[model samples]
Target: MAVGEEQKRSPREQKMLLADSNGQNMTALFSPRFKSAAAMAGWDEEALLLASLVVEDTPDRDSKHKRRFVLHSKTPPTNSSRKRRSQRTPQPVAILDLDEEETPRKDSGRKKKGKKISEGSKVEEGGNELTEKNPGVSSSSSVLPCIDKLREELSCAICLEICYEPSTTPCGHSFCRKCLRSAADKCGKRCPKCRQLISNGRSCTVNTVLWNTIQLLFPQEIEARKAAGILNGRQQAQNLSPESAFYATLMNRSTPPSGEASGRISRRNVATTTSRTQEDEDAALARRLQREIDEQSPGTTTRSRVHNARMRARGGISTSQHEDAALALRLQREEFMQTYRGSQEHVSSRLPSSTLARANLRSMASRAMNLRISDRRR
Candidate 1:
């Protein structure tokens, strides 16, 4: 029936049918599907040769028109074509004779296929083994050791633990705020690591950057450290004696009746109180010494004597006071000599004979001279 339909066609109609068939054949030849089919069939050389012949036989205008039509119909759009081109393996340029290329091409294709299969299998086995061995391996697990190291770096030197409520000193060292505060209270305002002067922990600011990083990396550890600190504080509070606890409560009070918002006494106030007490004691001692001096020298007034005694005690005696001291010493020496002479006279009177009296007087005079010499030396 198809042959009868062809025979019944007019001459012009027959020419049109032939042209249409030719056009269709040309489109197929140039299409990507035809090229891929030829490559898969291992007929690259034959396909190229056939394409060359057809291209040579077709007129330039008809070939161009047909190629355009084939591209528009059978080929993908530009974007899709680019994507396919990227995905497609590049074909090597054929330079050798067909006979020479055939064996090598077949062998190479087989070798490539075998290598791809082996490599794919090896990769699948490796992935499966990893999954089986370490099912928990993930981004978080991988970062754990790094986080631990960072925790060590951010730990307090005093407490030897991760810092809780991290604070920074002037010397650029960081520590747990509670640890630093306790150290400052016990050992003065000094850094534990560097032994440099630091502000008290109460005055020190939190290291915001280091604190944030520590919080991000070790939230649970920070929470644990904080909890431990709270427990320790509670334990210490419980251990305190009632009197000590009461004193501590008084010291910590923010608002006391005494107009001082800081309930604790300042160093300046303590020093001033000490000095005032010392001055009062010194004045009392001066008054006692002046009373003794006044009793020895009846002419001096109490006020002048007290002032003089105080000045003398302070190593700033005047010329007049020095003369008065010398006169007092002279008077004491005279009185001693008179008493010694009177005692010697009484002892001589008690003797029975002139010879014994003379001997006793000589002995007593020697003794008195010796005592006088000793007193002068003193």
Candidate 2:
């Protein structure tokens, strides 16, 4: 046979070839026990010989490919009119345009027949109009009630409509994101259905199945809801001053663009985002610790310890002896403070807690104590 030409085998020959290959220990190729044993024993002369034998014993491409190629007999063309006549179910009929093809009948008998045909055409046209107006009336009238029932089950309890941004609770109950968020904010972090405690820090995820179902069933409603939501959000945002809007734009822009880095930043600062009040409490605790250290230790040791703690808290950055590490540390702290201040100023009402109420207390208190001592000396 030519090198490029495919080898063809008869049915009998193909059957025998397949049977011979199947009779061999081809099961070992797929066996987990054999794979594990091979890994433990490692490849050797014996193993290599066995592999070569197995490869040789395996069925060729022609044999495997032959099994997949099915031969189907061609079906004869079907007559549309005959098929339509045979079918018992009624179908929407297309009205024919007869103005172009219609010819005048000169004979009186033929003219009478033409009038009858015209009357029948008028009756069919009326029927087509009725079907067009109430399309799928017979088939879909029964289905609509079931769909409305399903929509009721899927609707948000808070809104009493199809759920927007559907989110399911851990209790298997679902609600719209806005509705759930409103409930969480107004009430506690409790499931609306079961009253089970949900963590305030963790937000609910979108219910994909229910969301898709709602979209498929009530596409127009979903589109209208989305447009309304967009308008409302825009109006709310516009109600904010130019300065607040600009600050928000800047904050959104400052977030890391890379998805991985953004994810890491979000994960690392989750505690910070969860509670501005809690972060304030932690900072207060840190300052108290710093003051106690300052009083107990010498100035050099106290500063060094504080530097080390800050570095650790910030995820320590490495610096060579040539680089001014102190300046870099000061710059990072300043940047962090500025970011905090910007965010706090933008959402002061929402924050409901002072993140920097005691920001410089440690340094200011110590300086005042030193100033009093100097005054006593004077």
Candidate 3:
């Protein structure tokens, strides 16, 4: 029966049995107990008989057990074999499976067509494809609100607009440079925001980082502001008198003209010309008053005495360094009038108009003298 079973086994099973027997032979040959027994018995007849019986019995039992286990534990068909069999087999055609496979492609095609139509409509209506086509413009549009907030934060407190040529004060407040300068001129050298004293408002340096940021974010606004400022300056220059216009031009000139004197000399010349013009006007007024007084009282000792007193006052006023020359001359005229009033108490009642006229003329003369002395000092 064993022989029949062994013969009935497949060729692959028979090869597996031979490989198992060879492995068992290798393990037993190398085992310590077999080596020790061989050293002591030296291949005895009894040991050879026992080994033969053990080998024969073990193979029969192991072969039966291994064969049963291998047959029972046979692996299921692999994925590749199952897939090949599925492909070869004729499956039933279902309407639902066909529709499901085609649905995604149909939906995707419809979506693409819809997108094209929408884009075409947008282009036709807006006449601008930048928002859709240009990635950079779209990205920038997303942050537009942030940029606007930044612009508000960077705006000048004085002008209530985005700062052009931004300047920071010692108190860390910022404003447009032109606005800051104008504010300082109008309301003293103090920060418009914080009311902190600015030691040198004229010398406040531009905040380079803030300026660059403003330029970067608000280039169009900055250009517009600059153009407006230039236009305003031109309009002011046109409206100004020739002397005032010349002075404005002189002050605005960043560099001196070729072969011209320095700014200090030009400024001194302007001062001298102004003083001379003022002095000429005062002299003309004094002469006109004197002529009026002479016509009113042709040969009055009061007029002569008043004229002498004025001459003496003029000499003293010219020499004195008092800033309030006008007040001093007025005081002197009052003192002289009091003395005249006391001396001419009887004559003043007979010619009250003449006395009043003389007093008025003396007052005018004193004012003229004051003007001349002030101009000379200037």
lDDT for each of the candidates? 0.54, 0.52, 0.57
Model 3 per-residue lDDT tens digits across residues 1-378: 998666545544544454446445544655688766766877764566456646654744455456558788466544553243234312122233467789998998778667655643543333234445764552222234465577679999888999888899999999988899999999999998889999898986899868866655555567678768866875688497543443343233212331122433354455645544443444444357545434322224576456445545877753343324435544654554554445346444554322343454456667555555554555
Q: What's model 2's overall lDDT?
A: 0.52
lDDT per residue as tens, model 1, 1-378: 888655545543543443446555554657788667768888865557657646544553354456568778565445543244234322211112344679888898778667755654554455456567786642222243354566578889888887877888888888888788898889888898899988555686678767766665555566666657655764576478543332232222212332231222342344545544443443344344334434334236776567557556767545465565547545644553454345446645763222332343344345445543543343
Which runs in model 1 stand beyond 4 Å of their true positions?
1-145, 229-378
Query: Model 2 TM-score?
Result: 0.30
**Which residues of candidate 2, in runs, are more than 4 Å off?**
1-143, 199-201, 242-378
Find the candidate with the highest lDDT and give its number. Answer: 3
Per-residue lDDT of candidate 2, residues 1-378 (tens digit): 753232323433444444445334344444677656767888563655456555653543233234335333144334553233334121111111232234332355466556655644543454456567887543212234465577678799888988997998877778898899889888878888789877651577888757865665566578788768755755576478543443333333233342332443465565545444444444455455444434423224665456445545655342231133334334533554465566557545555323342343344345445533542343
How accurate locally is residue 241 in candidate 3, as Cα lDDT from 0 to 100? 59
Going through the candidates in the order shown, the clash numbers are: 0, 0, 0
- Ranked by lDDT, the better of candidates 2 and 3 is 3
Which one is best on TM-score?
A: 2
* TM-scores, one per candidate: 0.25, 0.30, 0.27
